[model samples]
Target: MNIDTIAKMLFFATVRIENHGAKSASVGTGFIMTASLENGDQCPMLVTNKHVLAGAQQLVAHFIPRKPEANVPDLGQAVAVDLPPTMYVGHPDPTVDIAVMPLAPTLLLLANKLFIQALPLSLLATELPDLYTDAIEEITFVGYPNGHRDPMNFTPIARRGITATPLQLDFGGKPMFLVDGSVFGGSSGSPVFLFNQGTYRSGPNVITAGSRIALVGIIAQTMLRNAQLPVAEEVAATAHVKFAQELNIGIAFNAKAIKESIELMVSSAGQHLATAATGDGVTELSPA
Candidate 1:
């Protein structure tokens, strides 16, 4: 597919995620991905940031009603599906901040009514030649900023930007990179895409890279600068300072991390399945 077509397809994989705490409610963005095994097995997973799910007693995923494509041109209502604890599978390392949840049950419920798509495992950097990540290119992400959606299509907003930092290099001592894009609270889990639009440089060599779309990383957090400089305790104790604005510097964990986490998920899923096959009522899935 062409770049535009591929972008539209990726949206089907991106969905609105809601994390409901016992007393408060919050929302974030996430996307879907598919992993294929050597044994000819394919697994569907839902991914998002770990912090987005923090303190959440319950989780709900919202999908745009597309498959049942509205008969009229006007916009329609969205479907909100509550997710059980057993439905989500998070990364073993709490520090990783990436979670994977099975999407089969969700797809079954939707009955193919939602026009969502899953990202192929081939789009992962770890699964591809190192040349892709070695090249610096433009990137984009779709997400709900401040819990806002299109309302018309019930889709998240698409934000485009370039890589402020190199993909293969670590940012601030972490396995992530800096993105020169505006990031908000609701964008915590947005997947960072590295889809080329035209010719770009590949390290010291130049190449005509076009229509190449791969998920290089996922937005983890954003950088913030103190709008009001902090004063010494002796000068102004308990001083109230002005709020800070988004630096538009986003932190995206390398997609390699996701690939590593997926391995853990595959193994755990096998064990979970074995237990389920025995009707043991044992499920080893939970949010980190």
Candidate 2:
């Protein structure tokens, strides 16, 4: 399909995470990992940058009701699912900025009340053959910038960008990649995907006609440059300043790190299997 069609699918997987701190509240983007169990079941878990929920006394996920024939999702009855900090499981590595929180038993019922679409763990960018990576030229990232969203349905903003550095090479000694895009505040934890449709050239004389899509990584942070000139604020006021300007470069943590982190949690005691009845008297399936 087109970008709009792909966006619709991606939007379902994206959620706005509202964090409540002691003195202030912040908003960021997060996507759900629909972990499938071998027993024909799925686990709904929230994944976001660890720093997004850092010092968060409370976490809530804002969801929009998605309809079949709407340009934007329906927001008439938006649902805010409450997430407890106690339920969160962080990556084993203290340095990795990824964390996950399972859906509470009570909130799990909302899955039926509204359309719940989550990103399947299978889409996690696994060990793709080098040939596929060689064919990839661009990727897309979806999220809210500066905490801005579609006023109608809270749809996350989608941005298209190209890889700024070598895929295999580590950026700043981390297993991450740099994206040349206008990523800003509130975009952290956004999912970066590589999608190719129509005709594509795999090699010098190799042409392909199928579509390809995969979740390659998630937004980590924006790169910056130390400005030679003082910022406007610094020039206006007489004070010592060391401010760096946005270099327009964005960082994406490799999906491998995320996969390892979540697996570590699930393999540990973080994975829970439970069932709860929905408002319609239907039971929902969850990871155990």
Where model 1 places Cα greater than 4 Å from the true spot, the runs are 1-4, 68-75, 133-136, 229-242, 271-288
- Tens-digit lDDT string for candidate 2 (29-70): 888777755445666778889988888899888887545564
Question: Would you estimate the TM-scores of all the predictions?
Answer: 0.81, 0.82
Alpha-carbon deviation at 46 in model 2, angstroms: 1.2
Cα RMSD to the true fold for all candidates = 8.6, 7.4
**How many angstroms is residue 71 displaced in model 2 relative to the true structure, after the best TM-score fit?**
15
Report, for every candidate in turn, its global Cα lDDT versus the true structure.
0.70, 0.71
Count of residue pairs whose backbone atoms collide, per candidate: 1, 4
* Candidate 1 C-alpha lDDT tens digits along 84-148: 64556567766778877777766786745665566766666665554444535688888888888
